[model samples]
Target: MNVVKRQIDLKRMFTCTTFADRVRFLIELAVTAPSTHNSQPWRFVITQESCRLWFEPKKQLKEADPSSRDLFISLGCVLENFVVAAQYYGMYKEVRLHMKENFVAEVFLYDRAAAHQEEYRSLCESILKRYNARGLFERTNIHEATLKRIEDIAQKYTEQGVRLQVVQNSTDIKNVAELTAKGIRIARSKPLFRKEFAQWFRTNLSKKQDGIPGYAVGLPLLPSFIAPFLMRYCSLAKVLVRKNTESILTAPAVCVIESDTDSPETWLQVGRLAERVMLECYAHDLATSIYVAAIEMDNMSQELAQTLELRGRPQFLFTCGVPLTNHRKFTPRLSVDLVLK
Candidate 1:
C-alpha cells in the first residue's frame, strides 16, 4: 500500500499535464536512492533555476558512522540520482558540491530535455528498477562480462581518488568475512552504538517514511519492535557475528569501493561510484547488499584496505551475485513537500 501510494504520487507529479519542471521530476528519482539505515538524510530547495540539495546532519548515524562519512556518502547517492535523472530528461545540470553541514550542493537546471532519449534510456530505466538485495544471494557466481561491465561503469567515474576493487576468489572473500565478523562483534557490543542503530528500525508501515523496515529485513512486525530493546540490553555479539560471517563466506563475490583519502568530498565521490555500480548491477540482472562493517569500523576499514593492498580508504563493501528473489517492495520515502526547504 505504501509503495502504491508513492508510485501514484510520482505519476501525478510527473504527468505531462502537470508543471513538468525538470527539478521536480528529477527529485522524484533522487529520493529513490538508498542510504545507510534508510535514513534518507536529504532536503531540497527548489527554485525556478536550480535545486539545492542540503544534507540533514541530524540524520547521521553517529554511532555507526562517527566520522559522518556515510552521511555525505548518502547525499552523494542522492546527487548521483539527480545527475542521472537530469541527463535522462534532456536537462543539463550544473552542480556545486559543498561538504559542510546540511549544505551539500546546488544543482542548476537547464530547460532543454534530453535531445536523444535513446542514449540515456538504459540507465534511466535502471533508476526505477534498481533495488538493494538484502536476502541471501544465490550461490552462483556472476558472469565475467557483467563484472567487467560494472567495473567499466566505476572506471568511468574518473574523479580523483575513488576506485572500485572487486573480490571474487574464495581466499580473499574469507579474509574479508573474518574482518567483517570482528567488526560486527565489536560494534554490537557497544550499548551506545546499538541504541543509536535501533532507532532506525520501523516495524509499522504508517509510522515512518524513512528507516529500515522490519519486513524489508525479513523480520516479523512484532519481533522487530522489540529489536531496539534487545540491541541495547542483550549481547548481540554472537548472533550478529555468526550471521554476518556466514553471509559473507557463502556469497559468491564482494565489492570493495574505496578512496585514496578519507574526506567528505572523497566519500561523496564514493557515493557516486557506488550508486553507478549498483545501478549497473540491475542493468546486468544482478543484486547487491551493502556490507558496511568492513568500512564502518575504523580499524576494520583500515585493515580491509591493507588486506586488499588498496592503498586507499575503504568506504563500502557488499555481496554481489544472483538474487534469490526480485519481489522487493520499495522502501518508503518522505513526501517531496516534507523535504522541501
Candidate 2:
C-alpha cells in the first residue's frame, strides 16, 4: 500500500461537529508528531469529554533507548500536537500531566465558542507539512529575524524548566559534529544496537504502519531491501559516522533542548518545547532533522553539556535549515483506531 494513504484527510477533520468527533480529529493530528525511528510509542484512551495519553512500552526501543528518554520525549511530541490541534479547533479546555502513572497526560475538551489564533492555526497546518529532513542541508544561515522568533518561543518555556540553545558558530558546530560522530561509532559498534535499529528500518515498499522508511534517508529500492540485513550483521559505524558528521557540519546551526532535571517530567517538557520549536521553524519555511546519538551515549551528554556550556542537562539535539531539496517524504503512521485503547 502507498504509505501516503495513511495520512488522514484534514477536510474530513473540519467536518467533525460533535465533541467526540473533534477529539478524534485532534488525536489524528497528534499521531503525526515525529518520534525516534518513527516508533510512535504512544497509546490513547478517549472519552466523550477527554483523552488520556499513555506510553506504549511494547513499542519501546530497548537496545537503542535504554533510558526511555526518547520514549517520553515522543509522548511529549504527541501531547503538543494534540494541544495544537485542540487550540486550532478551539476544543481544548486543559491538560494535566500524570508523571506517576503509565498514562502520561489527560486532556480535557469542551465545545465552548472560541476564536482560533493565527499562531495555533499555522502550527496545526504545519503538522502535515512537517517531516524530518534527513538529507544534506543548504549552506545558507537562518535569517536573524527567524532565529529571534525561535528564541522568543524558547523563552516562553523557561517557566517549565526547558531551554532551547542554538549553536551557529562554525567551531561550535564542528565540535558537536565530532561528538555526534563518536557517539554513532560507539552505538553502531554494539551488535544489539544494530539489530534493534534494523527492526524499525523499513524498505520503500514496506506495508508496516510504523518505522522509518528508506526513502526518508535517500535509500533506493534495492538498497532499502538490503539495509536491514546489512545493519543487523555488519558494522557500518565508519560509514554512518561519516555521513552523519557531514550532514551536521553542512548545516548552519545545531540546536540542543535542555532541562533542569533528567526525569520523565523533564523529558516530556523537553519534547513539547522541541516540537513547538520545530513547528515554528517550519512555519518560517525551514526544515529540521533530529540527532539523539550524542545525548543517548554514556558520558557524552555531560561532555555535550560542557561543550555547549548549558546550565541544564541536554535532552534533545537537532539542526534546522533550508534543505537541499523541496520534495518531502513522510514515514507511515498507524491509524487512530489501531492506537486507541
Candidate 3:
C-alpha cells in the first residue's frame, strides 16, 4: 500500500503538465543521489525540454579524490536515480554526457508519457531506504540463490560492460583482505589522505547523520580519539596507515566492480548496478560497506584485481556480509532541503 501511494504521488509529479512541476520533482529526487562525504557536489540546470546536471568541482574532495573518481561515482549514483525516477513517473528519458571544462549531463525527457513498470517502481522505492552499512556482519553465509540474484543485477545493462567479481571463497577473502590492508597502508603514508579524512570526520556527538557518522563505524568514542591526533603529528600519515589496515584486513568478503573503459558513463552504470545489488541484499537482510580507500591506491587495486581474476580496470571495492540480526540501524540522510537545489 505504501508502494502504491508512492507510485501515485510520483505519477502526479510527472504528469502535472506544468513544466515547473516536473523540473521541481526531478530536482528533488536528483539531489538525493549519494555523494562522497555527503559533499553533494552537483548542480542542476533544469529546463522544459531537458534537465542537465553539472559537477560543482569546487565542492569536490580535492585531496582524496584528486581526479574526481568518486565524484563521478556519486554523480553516476544520482544520474541512475534520475533515469529511474523519470521512468517511474512515466517519462521516456535519455542521458548523454556533455564534457566541457567540467563534465555535465544533459538529460532529455520526452514530454509525452508512458506506463511505469513494476521493476522501475521498485527501483524508485529503494532509493529512499538505500545507504551504506559498515557494521560487523553476521557469520551466516549468503545463499547461492541470493548470490545469483546479485549476479543477475550486475549482468543487467551490462552491455556497457562492468565486471563485478563477487568473492566468497575463504582464500579469495584473505587475498582481498591483504590487498585492502596494503592499500590502506599506502594511503595512510600520504599526508594528503590524512588531511582529507580529517576534514570529513565529524566531532558532533549530537547529530546522527552525515560525515562518516559514528554509527557507520559502530564506534561510539571514535571522534574523541580521532579529533586530537589526526592532524597533530608531522607524520599523521603513519597513524592513518595502521587504522585503515585494521579495518580492511578483517572484513568477511570483498567484491570488486570494474569496467573495460573507466569513463563517466561506465562508472554511472556501476553505481546503478551497485544500488541494485545493495537493495537486493537489503531485501534479504544483508549488508555492505564500500572500501574505496583500498582500491584508490594503484598498487592495492592491481593486487585486488589479480586476486579476484578480474578482466577490466577495477573501479570499486565492496565488502559485504550479512549483518548480525540485531545490528541494523538505518543511517540518517539530509532532508529534501539538504539535497534539493
Candidate 4:
C-alpha cells in the first residue's frame, strides 16, 4: 500500500456490524504504537469478543536488548493503543495480563456506553498523529501548566508503581546528557551491536513495511542507503555522541520513566505510561524524542538513577519541547494482516 492510503486506513474509524470487526479496527490503532527499531515485536489473535497479544521472540533485538526488556515494553505500548481505541468505541471490557502463558495480554470487549468516551476519543486521534520527533528542539522551557498536566498523567500510574520524572534544571539536564553520550559511545563500541542495529536501517526509497526509514531521521537518499554500512564498519561514535548531546541540551526538559520493580508486567506498565505521556505532549503541540541508551545499559541506568535521586528502576527516557523542524514522515508499520495469528 502507498503512504497516503496507509495513513487514511489508520486514521479511519470504520463502522462495524460485528464484534470481530470492531476488534480488528482497534488493532489498526494498536499497531501504530512505537517499538524499538520499529521491530514491531508483537502478534495478535482476534476472536469474537476479545483480542490476545503475544510477544514475537523472533523480533527481539539480541545485542541491543538481550534481556527482552524493550520487547515487553513494546508490547505494553500495543496494549495502551488497543485499550485507548477500544474505549473510544465503547467496546473495552477489561484487560488481563498473562505472565505464565504465551500471550502477554488478553483484552475483553463489550458493547456499551463508555465513560469518558470523548476524552479517550481525543487520545485515540493522537495515535495516528503522534511521531518520534528527532533533531534539535526549540530553546524555550515548557510552560508550568503543561508540565503539571503531564505530571498529573504520570501521577495516575503511581499506584501501579510507575513514575515519570521531568528534569528541567540546567545542571541535571547537562549531567543526563553527558551520561547519554557516554552510553551511546559504549554501546556502539561493540561490533555485534552495530551489526544488529544496521539490520533495521532502511534506505529512504525502500518499500519495506517495517523498519526505520532514512527520512524519519533527517537522512537524505544517498546517506540513508549507506547508513547501514557506516553504522556497521565506521567509527561514528564521537560524531553520534556530539550530536545526541547537543540535541539533549537544546530540549526544554529530559523525562525519565521509572518503575518500582523490574519484570515483564512492570515493563508493560511503563510502556503504557510512556506512550500516554507522549500522546499528551503531542496533544499540547509539543514534540518528544526517546533516548534510551542511557537507561538501557546497566551501569548507565544506575548512574542515572543516582543522579536524579530516583527511588525506582528507570525503564525509559526522552526529551520533550517545541521542535525546530517537524518530523512528518512516519516509520513504517507491519500490516494487521501480517501480524495476526
Candidate 5:
C-alpha cells in the first residue's frame, strides 16, 4: 500500500495543475536561465485567461551589460522554456514581435494536440535541472547520435531566423579553441573586467545568499580590500596569458549563433535559440557554457565565423562540454519569490 501511494504521488508531481499553475511552474524553471554575473536579469507578466507572456526590463545589469543584450538574451532563454513547458501542459504558444521602441515579445497560447508529448516534457524537465557547469568535464567524446539529437531540436523554429553552426571537424574545433584562449586573454587583461569580477567575488561563498559566490567562480581572491583596487589597475590579459592556453580550449564541441543583423530583436532571438540548445544538451548529459568574451575581438570573431561558415557576424559563442562522467552538484540560486519581480 505504501509503494502504491508513493507511485501516485510521483505521478501527481509531474501532472499539470492548471494553465496558470503551469505558467508559475515554468517561471520557476526560467530562473535557471544563465546570466553574465548570475545577474538573473529578467521578469515576466502573465494573464492566465489570455495566456499572454510579457518581458519586463525592470532588473538590468548596468556595468556588465550596457546595451541590455545579455539581459534580453536571458529573457529569451526563459521564453524558450515557456514555449516548451506550455506544450507539455497541452497548450501551444504563438509569439508576436513588437519592434518600435525596444524589442519585446507577446506570447499567446492555444490548445492543440501535440504529436511529440514526451519529448517536450523531457526538454521542459531539463530546464529545471540544467546549470552553467564550471567544473572540468571528463575527456569523453560526445556520440554522433547526440549531435543529431541537437540538430533535430534546431530544426524547430522556421521563422525569426536562427542559424546553428556546430563545430565538428578537428581543424575547426582547434581554431575555436585558439580564439577562445585569445578571448579569455583579452577579457582577463581589461582593468574594468577585473574590477567587475572582483565585485562579484564573495569571500564567504557559504554565507552568500545571491550573486556569483567566490566558490562558484573557482578563483581564489587576492585580499578582500586590495583585490578590487588592484583589479582596477592590472592588465587582466597579461594574467590569463600566463596560464596554460591549450588546456582552456578542450571542450568537446563549440557552437556559434549568428544573426543577419545585430539589432536588439535579433539578440533576443539568439538568446531563445541558445536556451533551446543548452537545455537540449543538458538532457543528453552534455554540459555547456557561453563564451561572449571571445567574439569581443575582431580577429577572433572573424576566425570563428569563418570556421563555422557563418556569413553574418558571429554574435555569440557557446561551448558545449560533454561531461567526463563524474558530475558536480549545480551552483545554488536565489529562491523563486526573490527572482520574480
Candidate 6:
C-alpha cells in the first residue's frame, strides 16, 4: 500500500509574501509525488522566475535500480505534479529536461500560467489522496467503461516513445503474476541485495521521514519492527513469495507502462505517464500499487515486454483494483527544508 508523504505546515509557506514563497509552495506539492520505495530522490533550487529540479545522486537506489530507471521515473512524477500545481496556481511552466551533473529537469515558471479551469481539477484533487494501495483488492472485474476511460487518460504528451497497456485476460494476468514471482526469486536469492533492500524499510514513522515505513507498505506495526531483523533470512522471503503472486492476481487490472528506449528522457516519460494513470485511477476510486523490483529484473522484463506486446521497454508495473480499506496514513518525505537547496 502507498501513503501520502506527510505535509509540511505550509501556513509559513503559503504567505506568498515573496516569490520564493510561491515557488516553495509548488515545490511542496511536487515532492508529494511518489517515488520508488519512497526514496524521495530529488532536490530543487528556486529562483524568482523558475524552479531548477535535480536528482540527488546519493539518493539513487543503486542496488534495486542500478540502471537508475526508477530514479528518473520518480523525478518525472514530481515534474508532472509541479506542472499541475503550477497550472492551478496560475503560472505557465516551460519545462526543459536535460542532463548536467546531477540535474534532471528545470522549469521556468512564467506569471501567465493560463487558467486550467475544469480540465485537470479532478486529477489534481486526487494528488494528495492517491497512495499506493498494495493490500488485497476486490476481485470484481473493472467495468469495460472504466477501462476505456482509463485508456483515454493514459495518452502521453509527446512522441518521445512511451506506452501504457492494461492486462485483464486471466491468462495474461497469470503470466504477469508468475513473472513477478520469478523476479522476486531472482532478487531474493542474493544476500547483499536482500541486505540493501532491507535498509529501506523504516520500521516506524518516527524513525525517518524518507524510505518505506513498514505499515505504509502493508506490514503491520509489529511485523514492521521485526522485518529488519528477519529480512536477512532468505527463507523469510521465500515464505512471502507466494503472497506476492497471489495478491498480484487479485487486481482488477494491471498496468504495464513502458518507453521506447532506456534513457533519462524516456524513463522520465514513464514516470509522468505512470502518475497520470495513477491519478486517473484514483479519480475512479481505484487503488494503485507500483511494482518496480520485478520490472528491474532484465529477464522478467523481457518476458513481460513480449507478453504485453509492448514495442518499447517496460519500466513500471502496477495494479488497479477496488480498495478493501480507505488507508488514511501516508508514507512520509523529508521536510521541505531538507529537500530545498
User: Backbone clashes per model, in order?
Assistant: 3, 0, 0, 0, 5, 6
> What stretches of model 4 exceed 4 Å from their correct place?
1-6, 9-11, 112-116
lDDT of 2 by residue, 165-229 (tens): 99999998898999999899899889989889999999999999999888888888899999989
Q: What is the TM-score of each candidate against the true structure?
A: 0.91, 0.95, 0.80, 0.94, 0.79, 0.91
lDDT of 3 at 309: 81
| Model 5, runs deviating above 4 Å | 1-19, 50-63, 99-103, 110-116, 204-210, 219-248, 297-300, 339-341
lDDT of 5 at 320: 73
The candidate maximizing TM-score is 2
Using TM-score, rank the candidates from best to worst. 2, 4, 6, 1, 3, 5
**Stretches of model 1 off by over 4 angstroms after superposition:** 1-21, 112-116, 204-206
TM-score of 5: 0.79
> Which model scores highest in lDDT?
2
Candidate 4 lDDT by residue in tens digits, 227-260: 9899889768998888789889998999899988
- Which tens-of-lDDT digit does each residue in 226-334 have in candidate 5? 5445555676555444332333356667777877777777877888888999988877777776767657553566777776678877867776766433433344556
- TM-score for candidate 6, please give it: 0.91
Q: Considering only N, C-alpha and C atoms within 3 Å, which residue pairs clash in candidate 4?
A: none
Provide C-alpha RMSD values for all models, in order.
3.0, 2.7, 4.5, 2.9, 5.5, 2.7
Q: Which ten residues in a row have the lowest lDDT in candidate 4?
A: 1-10
Report how far residue 49 has shifted in candidate 6, in Å: 0.8
Lowest summed lDDT across 10 adjacent residues in model 1 is found at 1-10
What 10-residue stretch in candidate 5 is worst by lDDT?
1-10
